[model samples]
Target: MSPINFTHILTQAVDELSESESYKGLFHQHTDGNPLPSAHALCNIVELARAIIFPGYFGNSTVNSRTVTYHIGVNVERLFDLLADQIWAGLCFGGDGECNACNEYQREEAAQLAANFISRLPQLRRVLATDVEAAYNGDPAAHSFGEVISCYPAIRAISNYRIAHELLLLGVPLIPRIITEMAHSETGIDIHPGAQIGSYFTIDHGTGVVIGETCIIGNNVKLYQGVTLGAKSFPLDADGKPIKGIPRHPILEDDVIVYSNATILGRITVGRGATVGGNIWVTENVPAGARVVQRR
Candidate 1:
């Protein structure tokens, strides 16, 4: 038998991969001296943000009233530094391809965006505190707020979502999606950072939950496992491509409760105090205080 030409095969593979047509519309070409977004750095940013928000529950477990201020100040400073760099990378990523001057402008813009996000951290924490409380009070199994914060996957996922959502609101592109996808990978809860979730949002046994990009969930909403708030259909363009940035997902008003495995789709509204039961598919608007369950 003849020996294989390993070097020739490698050369052929590299040539095929490097072809412009092979990677068209899928490749991100890095400009000289410009950095792309790093998943590891973004992970660190999430961790830092979580620590700052939850204090002793995450990093610096020894934090008390005496050193809480110092710990938070340090974490916020570090978070600002890391977030600024990643936001800069995201801006570069979404900028006009191969433009050097645009990259410099985005760098400054990223810093300002990062600072704006940092300013919102206090409000973010306040909203997340409501989430933690909602999870604890809604679940009988939850022993304490500490248990919910320390042991709940919902808290972890929601914390990342809140952080990512704030960054998205601040107009830092690419990085927010990366941060939320990191949460989605870790916990099976897939929440788009573009979703507008109000305070006191709780997801019980949150695996398999998907909140779509245009979803608007109001305060005190509780979702069980396998619930999906998604779009029913996409409005396409003349070219048959789905039009981007339309209000397609459902809206849940205040104090609504959706049970496990319930799928709510489209731009319909679930009125205040409505309850959607498990394993049901709802595409229309549900009236206030209405109960929707499977017709057995």
Candidate 2:
């Protein structure tokens, strides 16, 4: 080789192997076979769940009452398998421990949990039906139930929450958060899987809505955009660190409606049929049927 070529090659090698330089590791710490979740798949699952819950409204083919049963049966079965795969990915992602067994064994356990969650879909739909009705009746601009069902972010968010909540109840780890987060990104509504909400709930223009963990929302409660049912502040532990798991969020009794931009803090309760006006702040319990509108 020429003198300049040889010198250049030697210098490049020394620079690469220098003390301050290093090689990028090609091996990853995690190489599990579980499918990595795609936001697309979660979105697809949301759409599929909606179609399964209310037949003929979603999906490609036309559905009739006779075909409805078959359609739901098929979708639920597919949903169970697909969701199980995604949930398995989530669990593995979150250090839920390794399965020392063969691939078949892990896949089998996932299938079982997925099947268990799928079987509960009927009950989930029943709760969501009340949500749809509440949204439709509460909004006069809604032309029909079909319009509300077809075109409401609230329905989509609620559907994702119902599905995720069921998984959380079943103690299926990791995947529930991914499922709910997908809805949050799509709908701008943040309802944590740990939040305990009851039937006939509705949220209008639900962007920036924060329903924290331990929040107990009663039946017939409606929340508008920018509403917050959050803890006043996290109380410090004996070590001066934030404590966990006490009831920190506000509770709304039956028939309460909180309008846009209202901030309700702490473990307080707004009593039955109370109307909290827009852009107000609430920290204490509101009595029944009380209309707390903004002054002037």
Candidate 3:
């Protein structure tokens, strides 16, 4: 084609691309003061939370016993500010177009939610400590708590899950999923923020694990790599769209251990002390204390 023809085509393409209908559902228009949630800021927020929850392991390495409280105080304050903004962004993103009353409500709610989340920090730390313990005690190759905190993929993934879960419970949206997905991308472990997990939960090998939304996991449970607790099928509505919020994932009771590559489907309960061995398919309720292994 001639250069003139090429220029004409380029101009036509620009006009076509600029049409609103062409970009519907794809483009997000920026409002004057309503900012969209940022991946960068959320990453920093997660790091800040990690530093506060597990001091000396993340963020400032120079934090000592004498300075720990000061560091935590500063991180908490910073986290609150960052979290409030992100929460507000998330609210505005999920909300209708900005109104004065609505914006004010979102701002105030964001701060309140952020404060509530901060208040839960102590319990989060305590619960995460149990997870650290679980990881250390469950892994024969793990040498120290420090190793688990510093090096284990499970710690990172689980820590993100716990943080996201707390935020989700506090009624913050979008941001929680982003936080967990960040860990999922980095660790190859996908734990939905809606999953209800209990204390002393640990994932061995920590890769290829999928804990679906609506999963209710009890305390002292262990899951190996490649294990999935997923729904067997989705129930659809009259419109043929999958119904939302139905409890479809597996529920694991206390002291249950699911080995690597095991797929436990449906809303069935794996009773307390049950063991589902590696590379198997489980579609039914497992009684308490039963050992489910793959048939040779």
Candidate 4:
């Protein structure tokens, strides 16, 4: 070896071995980073799935039944592979170093669950198609189903929620929250993946809507902008720490319509076909067909 090359190698070795190459700048505060498959990657997968399911509505194409089947088949295969990898990453993220003996078993279980979720895509697409129809038919200015699929915030928000909710149900961790937050950042509609929302769900001008964890939403429910189905904060634990998970958020029965700027907290239920008017603060239950309007 040349003397110069040898000297350079030796210098690098010394610097690294002596800890002179401080990697302190590699990380910053406010990050306890669990490196894994990104939320963005999973988000793209959902986007692709939407395109596949809706075909020409989402992508620029002339989608016949044959093309539709082919697209869905390809998407399903890709979805399975991506789901397995991301779920594995999620398994390792909060649960470290192969975690426990149960971790391996759980990983297999989660994978099976994820595969099952992919299998349900047809059903999900069916329900989502209804959403697209609702959006198109509800809006007089909507030119076509294609317009609703491409431009509506409601469709976008609902798509994200459906994908994230499936992941959450499959016991795939971390990623679901990330996926939901991506939609939240984009649409200003925050629906927790853990929240159970039923079919025919509609959100009009969906900005600033916050649906919390443990919320059970019945079929045909509608929510408007600035509505918060949130939790009531109670006293801290004996250790003076905030509790992680509790049954805290509100529930909406079938056909409920919660309007703009309304804040419904705690375990209250807004019953069937009820219309909660704008700017109302509700902590108590509203019975069936109830109309809750703001005073003055």
The clash count of every prediction, one per candidate, is: 0, 0, 0, 0
Candidate 2 TM-score, true structure as reference: 0.83
Better of 2 and 3 by lDDT: 3
Q: What is the C-alpha RMSD of each candidate to the true structure, in Å?
A: 1.6, 5.4, 2.1, 6.9
Candidate 2 steric clashes: 0
Over 1-296, each residue of candidate 4 has an lDDT whose tens digit, in order, gives 64445878899888886673464444322223333666666876777678767776654377677677777677677777777767766665543333323346656765786688887788888988877876676668889987888888888988989888977876777888888888899999999999998888878888999999989999888888999999987557999987777889999999898889999999899999999999989999999999999777
Q: TM-score-based ranking, best first?
A: 1, 3, 2, 4
For each candidate in the order shown, give its overall lDDT on alpha carbons: 0.91, 0.83, 0.94, 0.80
Q: What is candidate 1's lDDT per residue for 1-296, written digit by digit as tens?
A: 99876998899999999999998877766677777789999988988888898889889899999999999999989988998898887776744444233456787888889889989988998999999999999999999999999999999899999998888888777788888899899989999999999999999999999999999999999999999999999999999999999999999999999999999999999999999999999999999999999887
> What's the CA RMSD of model 4 in angstroms?
6.9
Error of 1 at 273 (Å): 0.6
Please state the error at residue 135 of candidate 3 in Å: 0.3
TM-scores, one per candidate = 0.95, 0.83, 0.94, 0.81
**What is the C-alpha lDDT profile of model 3 across 1-296, one tens digit per residue?**
64445878899999999998898767665667776889999999999999998999999999999999999999999999999999988887843333222378889999999999999999999999999999999999999999999999999999999999999999897899999999999999999999999999999987999999999999999999999999999999999999999999999999999999999999999999999999999999999999999678
Residue 109: error of model 4 in Å? 5.1
- Among all windows of 10 consecutive residues in model 1, the one with the lowest summed lDDT is 94-103
Quick one: ranking by lDDT, best first? 3, 1, 2, 4
